[model samples]
Target: MTDPADMIVPLLREMRAENLEQHEQTRALVRALDKRLGGVEDAQKSYRQALTADTLLSKLVTGEFEERIEALENKVRELEGHK
Candidate 1:
């Protein structure tokens, strides 16, 4: 009969090889996930920049409209005083 310890060596070698292969696959998956996460982060930054620009433009336009309305109201008050 074959020695049991001699058989165990080959089995251990096979398990070690399989474990190495699985470790490489896990590393590849993590790299792919990291790449995808970078893309998502870039998109979020672009969206945030666009939102900030839009908010600034809205505030400026609103300020100009308010100024024009105030001027018109002052003119109406001046005309009433003349009458």
Candidate 2:
């Protein structure tokens, strides 16, 4: 009968190689997912900032509702001068 150790050696080496290949493929997939998630997170942050900036700009434009704000300020100044 053939030596059992000799018969098992080749089988063990093949299994090790397959395991290594699977491990490398899994690592690659994880890296790809990480990169995609990073991009999504960055995009979300940028969009939030842009929306905040838009809201601030809208408030600034609309907060100054009347064109007579300067006249109102001058009238207040005149009243303060009398006091």
In candidate 2, which residue pairs get closer than 3 Å at backbone N, Cα or C atoms, i.e. clash? none
Q: Which ten residues in a row have the lowest lDDT in candidate 2?
A: 62-71
Q: Local distance difference test, per candidate?
A: 0.99, 0.93
* Model 2: per-residue Cα lDDT over 3-40, one tens digit each: 99888989999999999999999999999999999999
Give a tens-digit lDDT track for model 1, residues 1-83: 99999999899999999999999999999999999999999999999999999999999999999999999999999999999
RMSD per model, one decimal: 1.1, 4.2
* TM-score per model over all chains: 0.90, 0.68
| Clash count in backbone of candidate 2 | 0
How does candidate 1 score on lDDT?
0.99
Candidate whose lDDT is highest: 1
Q: Relative to the unseen true structure, what is the C-alpha lDDT of residue 5 in candidate 2, on a scale of 0 to 100?
A: 85
For candidate 2, what's the RMSD? 4.2
